[model samples]
Target chain A: MAEIVLNALAHTYSRKPNAPQDYAIRQMNQVWEQGGAYALLGPSGCGKSTLLNIISGLLEPSDGEILFDGVKVNSLPPEERNIAQVFQFPVIYDTMTVFDNLAFPLRNMKTPAHLIQSKVHEIADILELSPLLHKKAKNLTADEKQKVSMGRGLVRDNVSAILFDEPLTVIDPQLKWKLRRKLKQIHDQFNITMIYVTHDQLEAATFADKIAVMYEGQIVQFGSPHELFENPKHTFVGYFIGSPGMNFMNVQLEEQHFVFEDMKLKVPEKILDKIQHLPYESIKLGIRPEFVHVWDKKNDEAYEVDVIDSEDLGTYHIMTFKLRNQLLKARLHEDQRIPKHKAWISFPDQWLKVYVNEYLVEADDE
Target chain B: MNKIENNKAWFLVLPVFVLVAFSAIIPLMTVVNYSVQDVFDTNTRYFVGTEWFKAILNDAALQSALMKQFMFSFTTLSIEIPLGIGIALLMPKRGMAASLCLVLIALPLLIPLNVVGTIWQIFTRSDIGLMGWSLREMGVAYNISRNPVDAWATIILMDVWHWTPLIALLCYSGLRSIPEAYYQAARIDRASRWAIFRYIQLPKLTNVLIIGILLRFMDSFMIYAEPFVLTGGGPGSSTTFLSQALTTMAIGQFDVGPAAAFSIIYFLIILAVSWVFYTTIMNMQKEK
Candidate 1:
């Protein structure tokens, strides 16, 4: 397996992409270490598939170079690039038996007859498709068909990476969990670089070792799931990851206090110093809904807000409140007292994030 | 629950009854009546008791003509199916060029049957037509009337030119319905071009090809107007087909009794052949 590197890669569907809007994938760079489980996570139509296609060599990038193990692979076809891709929908040869479907890649490579047979059996056993090997692929259920498709890729040993593009969209919710666990097992067993692309944050977080948060055709932040939740580098990530997501309020810096619409809050010296180095234009303050501490009584550092709406979501409650006319969300535990119409909230220093131009500013050295 | 036997539902089916009667049963009954009768006039007809049917079945010329018709249909099918698939495979998948090509290929299919006959009739003229004149200039001796081989070749070529596009268009739509992901997966699997076609394209195209084959077979089997216009049972009745023979007996010579029997036999042949083809293809699908 090779370490995949996308060096300043960009792509566009137009013949001449003169404007930035014309590009489907804007110029960016990313690297996936060998055997790393990475998820390229984004909303629908955010170029997650485009990036995956490029990495799989199905679609060549308009600009920049793709290196595998530090060697350029721009001129290589997908077959020569040694990459396998599983698509959003299961793709299998309908006329063939499940055994033949799994054996396809090895047969294509002209592996010896006995090796092909043994490899097919191995992959079929791993996918739990040994019993259905004699059955036609067309007759299988959606998840079984998906496993067969994935098994086609796994049958070959020469592949450098396996790219999955929303492979669970067609599967029912009940089966998705089992299939995902199977994928995790496969990853652990084979130690090959796997890049999973999806719009569901839960799928990304649960399956990937490192989740790359993509926004507007760019990878905004790449880190572990815990890191992405603890610190979303971009405002989009903050708004995307959690249940109600992180609440963001546009603020202006004035006299060491962050001022918003009809509201003001003092900042610590270290955070203020970091904010000073960043441009004062387009400043925003962000905090996760889980971290916004709601209080029944007014504290010294608390800002009182009207509790506009609160949803009882079984275990916890998501309370939407207005802070100085700006709406915000906070997650409260089940045992916490429910505020009627008014609640005092405090943005704790540790949870508060100062954003300059929609990008998070480090309040302290890591 | 009480079971009520109501006779009123039959009235609700009157439209279908009248439709089936007018469209099928009436005409078929008339043919059967003619097949079994010796009718000098509508008022003076006698029950002949299968005499005409026996006579028609025993006709040697008509038997040869049926054989000739089968040959024509078989040849045209064998040529058109593979050629159509090849053309579909080679066709551009999208954009302005694809649109232009589709329209051009469909042009001949829209032409009236007689018009197609007239076009090919003139187009293959040895003296003036583009192709015929070119062949004559190239020192090739080609005359559709005097030579049986030339006549057969011309009719087959004309039929291929007129009908290959229908199959091609069906196959093109079928090929387009296949997801792009299949091809991408094949590429990643390192499949050869032939392997992709064999396992992917051909399997996906099975239903469309079945429909195309049955359609072409039935249409070619019943073909009349084009060949009739071009040849008119020419030279020595060498190109006479089942429909042409029936038309000559019923309309040309007013041999209604034998011609009615002939038409019924022709209809049965088409039905039986199409059913056989459909069932065979379906069984193949099931076995796979």
Candidate 2:
């Protein structure tokens, strides 16, 4: 395990980094601590994989330095980085037997033959791949081939980190869960620094100790899965992390009152004073589907809604409604029923989030 | 699943099958008919039951030509496959450069085969040709038309120049088909460049290499036009490969029956050799 420090690291594919948009990855300042299970999560083409590649030393950054355990490694190649990586698809040597595929890196490093055998057997056992060890790798099932890919990476004990790049995308859903669990177990047992890159929220939430949410080549937020869910730092995060993500309604803020369309809702005295000094004309209110409560019209704080659609998802229902021309989704308990024509919804004060120009506006100090 | 209801799809392939059968089957029937007969003139002919086959088998010249053909094919394949793969590795993976390399490499293949032979014949001449002049200026006695060593060298070099690009192009396509993710996986494994090439790139190229080898072997074994035009199978028959020998027997000596029998033997040898190469590669792939 090693502490990885990215010091103003940036990359540009072009010769001249003349424009801001020309950079594939902007200056990134981060410190991923030793033994931490980190995830770089984002949509496609967001520089997540690029960042992973830079760290792995497959690509050189245009500027700045990367330090692993306080030693500068920006000039090091991948072989010198001492990291293991599992790719999106299995990259096993199809001509080699499963045992040989797993044992290749060890053999390349000139590890003793007996030790290679024992270590391969150990990883095969952990991955439940011992029975198929004698078989050629090409004949294995997709899931089994993926296990061989994983085993190849895992067999090396001296690797400073293990990187997984959407490794489960090709795997069947059933096998993905088992592999995720197995990866988690390996991480726990070995305590190596692991960085997993994926676009899937569930996989990110399940495997990562800290999730670094990336959008448009920048890390928007880096925190635990719960922090991302409860307090998204950017609007992209709010819309990206949850199943039915947080809904945003544009509001006009004046002096001490917030107006949503024609309805002026009194703001909490503290939040009102903080935004008064900012020069933003509009404030957006964000609330998760689980936080929006649908209630009777007689409820004092409830705002009126026109139900758009309702999808029954076995355990719960996702009820989509419109409030002042903005679409909003609400999650209701299995037994809860609401009229399709009109409904009243209310946001709990604690769960209400405010954003100014796509950036999260922190709550005011009391 | 029920049988696919797309009957119209068969129309897309009908023209191809029809063209292939017309070109392939008719010529094959002609060859088969010629193989079993002796033609004395336009009208006089006799059915020779395996007499020509026995004569061809016993012919010392035919046996030597077969040996020379195998050696030429083997040498050409040995030189071209690795050279092609090396050039392919040096090629850029993307952008205009990759396209440029592809176009340049494909130029030779696009040229008519006889034209390639004619061009090389002039290019390797001792007096006026640039290659010959340069070699002479560099203090080497090089005359392809009269010297067996020079003739052999010129032919091998020409074969390499003409066909190495094909292997390289096939290898390039195979290399390009590999996803970037595989390289990422290699990097994470901390694999050396050689290890990655051996384990990942080489195995990935095996299928294409098999095809490349078979095509190159068939072409080189049957090579007649280029060497015939350049050296005229002279320099003392050193470059007289099987196809040249067959041409000499049929056209030069006009022994139609023996030549017909020789061609059948030649075709069978190619078929048997190609089958061996294909089966060996497929079996190796299966074992993996």
Candidate 3:
């Protein structure tokens, strides 16, 4: 395994690609450590796959230097990079037996016959595909075909890394969990550097050691799942990471107090001072749905809210309300009783975040 | 609501069956009748009991034509299949270039069979055609109208030019049907260009290639119009294929009994060969 470094990486497909806006991927500087399981996670058209392709040597960055183990590899082809990939759909030689499909790369590399059989058997056993060894790949079911595709990547031990691009999208929902867990097991056993690309947050959270959340052709945040969930640096991160994502309500800061509609709430003095000098006309208070506590009546710590609707989701209730005419969601315990017409909630100052123009503003200690 | 049952669907196929019966079944029965009889015109017919079959079985002319047909089919298949695939591989996958390539390839297929023959007839003449004049200027002694070797080369080249694009277009559609993710996976596997073609592209192309081979075989075996027009079975009958021989017996000699017998045998040969090709390809595909 080798540490891969991307230095000032940017790509543009046009002939005259000098302008900053012409680039699909802007200048990105990052290091993917050896033997780490990383994921490039983003919505469609977000350039996550582009970044993965560039790293695999399938695409050359218009301006950048990529180094593998401190050796320049930007000019290398995929064959020279020594990496394996599993696609969203299984790509197997349909005319060959399942065994042949797995053994093809080894055969191309001129591995000895005995070693090829042993390696094929080893991977087949791990993937639980021993029963399909003699069958033609085209005759297999979709999941079986996908297992063959995965085995082709896993059977080789000499590769530097394995890249997966939404490899489970075609899998049945019931089988996705099993395959994902199996992949994690394989990674743990092999300790190979793996980079997976997907738009599914749950898949990225469950699979990768480090998740790089991308948006609009840029890496919005690169951190552990916990870090991304707890302390999102950008507004898009807050809006994207959760199921019922974080809520952002506009507020006005005056001294150590913040005003929302007719209500004034006290904030920490330092946070108030940090925002006082900003030119923005409004500040945003961001909080996750689970962190907001709903109350039955007005209290010193609570803000008045007009309840709109409540949806019971078996394990929890998703309560929707209007604060200063802006929609907000609050997750409450399943058994908790909430009043229909009116409700009050407390935005715990400790969990509350302040933002100015999508960038997080410093919070002051009161 | 209950699902609608359409038992009357058979009515929709009745006309097709009648048309096929009139066009295929009646002629087949007539050929079978002639195969077993001796006829001296519409006035007299006699039961001959497979005498013509025995004669055809031993005839040297029949044997030579059969060998020629086999060579033609095999050569055409070998040249067309790979050339088509190579051209298709080089074609742009999408956009204006794809449409342009498609139109250019399809142009030859849309030309009438007789027109293709007439066009090549003039195109290969030593005095007027660009190809013939260029060959002469390059110091090559070439004349399709007089030389057997030139005749064979010209016919083969014409067939290749007319039909290779069909196979290529079919293979092109097959290649396009593949998801981009597969290519990505191949790249990730660090598969060499040869490995990618052998393992991924070729296997994916099997179904279309089968169609291409069968179609090309059937078309090449029945070839008559172009060679008949260009060579006119000349240079001592070097290019007189099975179809031309059958037509000579039926139309030129008016030997109905022998011609009918030959037609039946010719039809069966094509059917049997096509069956073998289909079965072998399908079986190979199944093994994978």
TM-score for the A-chain in each candidate structure = 0.97, 0.96, 0.93
**lDDT score of residue A123 within candidate 3:** 98
Share of native interface contacts recovered by each model: 0.86, 0.73, 0.61
Q: What TM-score does each of the candidates earn? A: 0.98, 0.92, 0.91
Could you say which candidate leads in DockQ?
Answer: 1
| Superposed model 2: Cα runs more than 4 Å off | A364-366, B1-30, B134-139
DockQ of each: 0.78, 0.57, 0.56
- In model 3, what lDDT does residue B28 have? 86
**Which TM-score value belongs to model 1?**
0.98
Residues forming the 10-long window of minimal summed lDDT in candidate 3 chain A = A357-366
Ranking by lDDT: 1, 2, 3
Q: Give the TM-score of candidate 3.
A: 0.91
Over the stretch A1-366, how does candidate 2's per-residue lDDT look in tens digits? 678899999998999779878888998899988889989999999999999889988899999899999999999987788877777878888778999999988987889999999999999999999999999998998889988998887888767888888989999899899989999998898898999999999999999999999988789999999999999989899999998999998888865778887888778776776777888855888999999988956477888789999999999999999998888999998988755779999999888888888888876562
User: After superposition on all CA atoms, what RMSD does each candidate show versus the true structure?
Assistant: 1.4, 3.8, 3.3
Q: Residue-wise lDDT of candidate 2 within B94-153, one digit each (tens)?
A: 899999989998888887777888888888765777888788889998887678888888
Q: Pick the candidate with the highest TM-score.
A: 1
Ranking by DockQ: 1, 2, 3
